[model samples]
Target: MSRLPDAPPPGAILEAAVYVSDLDAAEAFYGELLGLPRLMRVPGRHVFYRVGATILLVFDPEGTTVPTSDPAIPVPPHGARGEGHVCFAATDAEITAIRARLAAAGVEAEADFRWPNGARSLYVRDPSGNSVEFAERALWG
Candidate 1:
């Protein structure tokens, strides 16, 4: 089947979201451990972090599944029940530093290896059981 006609050209991802059960744990794991700058947070609802030019959104499933009273930013109610995944781009040296940081934090890499393209990836889980990945840009190149 041919691609849909008249589809407007899309830009790079501005943000990606993953639902968590606990906001506090997610905050510590992402903000503290990963060293990503905290953008904003609404306690018990969601937390946002800056990852390069994009944003990483950690949301509490229960809190987001319900409609908000405010109409200013009427983001539609949406949530996922189970695990979600997000990948962060990293360089070789950055991957090494990340490995050391994870070891210091006692977090094991669920999967760490080089892809067929020779790009390395390190995978781990947050307290919310979401699959987090870090890989070099060459992995997709």
Candidate 2:
């Protein structure tokens, strides 16, 4: 694991990916519902959204496991099956607002509780059944 003995730690996470059954559903959940600004949409393949400084890469499993036709950016084929989880950092008030938005859209939070550290977390499932969570910043501290 020491391939680069002097390599510095990454400054921050540039992106995170979660494979879904459909790209449209992913857009509805992340782009419309969660209100994340979508950066790009490669129809039938993937969608990219901005979350603060990080990009949320929503990919369709059917397309990700295959090779790209483009020769310029030959991204290696990689994909996952089933549901995955992603947590977003939020303030206490922001979490409350998010819960209300989900409720208005008839999307219920699967769980909402406080941790021993006095931080709270709200979990809900997207259209693709991925567990998406919004937690207080203090939760990590």
Candidate 3:
């Protein structure tokens, strides 16, 4: 087996791609509900949003035909269990405000949890059932 080199020195994560059932609704949810600004729109195929310093790319699942399997690749179902959640880091007050914002947008969020590292976090599911988390460190420098 051949192994590739590790990722080069760390840098900011520039973007995340999410598959959405409805591109328009996803765009509205991310842009209006989460307050992310739309960075680009690719007609009926995709929409990119600027979330803080990163870009959130939303694509239509039905419009794109992704391969299910390949010898050197692994692909799960459209929605699969055990996939990790995406965490968005914020301050304590920001987390609180975000929770309120979600509520005002009619989105239900799970209860918050405090980790052993003193980081507080909460989880919510997007329209496509992807898990999203908001976390805050207890102490700031």
Candidate 4:
């Protein structure tokens, strides 16, 4: 039914974007907590961070002129709960420390998930109520 490339190597994931209510606060949380390097910033509008081989973009929802409703599509209200979140991979040791750090910083986290692929993860929220996850893959060992 479909053609496929023969023996094609897997390509690296480049980037993902998440819209946020406050650009500055998102920048602070990710930059400080996850230790991601800030790659770029657009005044009052957007911030991009380097996460491993991927780029994570945080855009200000209020600053964007995109319409909330249209005949073809509908957008969620700003800061809607359970919409989406970003996940960052870490080492097992780092994962434990990060959870403690987030707790001390007053960030709430869901119970950790230990997957069959030897990966463990925990979910937490940022200042804007968007969820975030920290994961560690045992395969790295």
Q: Which candidate comes out best when scored by TM-score? A: 2
Candidate 4: where is the Cα deviation over 4 Å?
1-10, 62-82, 116-118, 138-141
Cα lDDT over the full model 1: 0.93
For residue 124, model 1's alpha carbon misses the true position, in angstroms, by 0.6
Q: TM per model?
A: 0.93, 0.94, 0.73, 0.72
Model 4 global lDDT (CA atoms, 0 to 1): 0.76
lDDT per residue as tens, model 2, 18-109: 98998887899899999999999988889999999899999999889889888999999999999999999999899999999999999999
Error of 3 at 90 (Å): 1.0
| Backbone clashes in model 2, listed as residue pairs | none
Task: Residues 56-113, candidate 1: write the lDDT tens digits.
Answer: 9999999888898899989899888899999999998998899889889988899989
Quote the lDDT for 42 in model 3: 64
Clashing pairs in 1: none
Cα-based lDDT for every prediction: 0.93, 0.93, 0.73, 0.76
Query: What lDDT tens digits, residue by residue, belong to model 4 across residues 64-118?
Result: 4555556666654442223467778787788889999988888777767787787
Residue 12 in model 1: lDDT: 90
Q: What's the CA RMSD for each of the models?
A: 2.1, 1.6, 5.8, 6.4
Q: Tens-digit lDDT track for model 3 on 11-90?
A: 87887777777677776677888888888886655788877788877777654455445657555435223323567778
For candidate 2, the 10 contiguous residues with the lowest summed lDDT are 1-10
Which ranges in model 1 have alpha carbons more than 4 Å from their true place?
1-5
Q: Report residue 15 deviation for candidate 3 (angstroms).
A: 1.2
Regions more than 4 Å wrong, model 3: 1-7, 66-84, 137-141
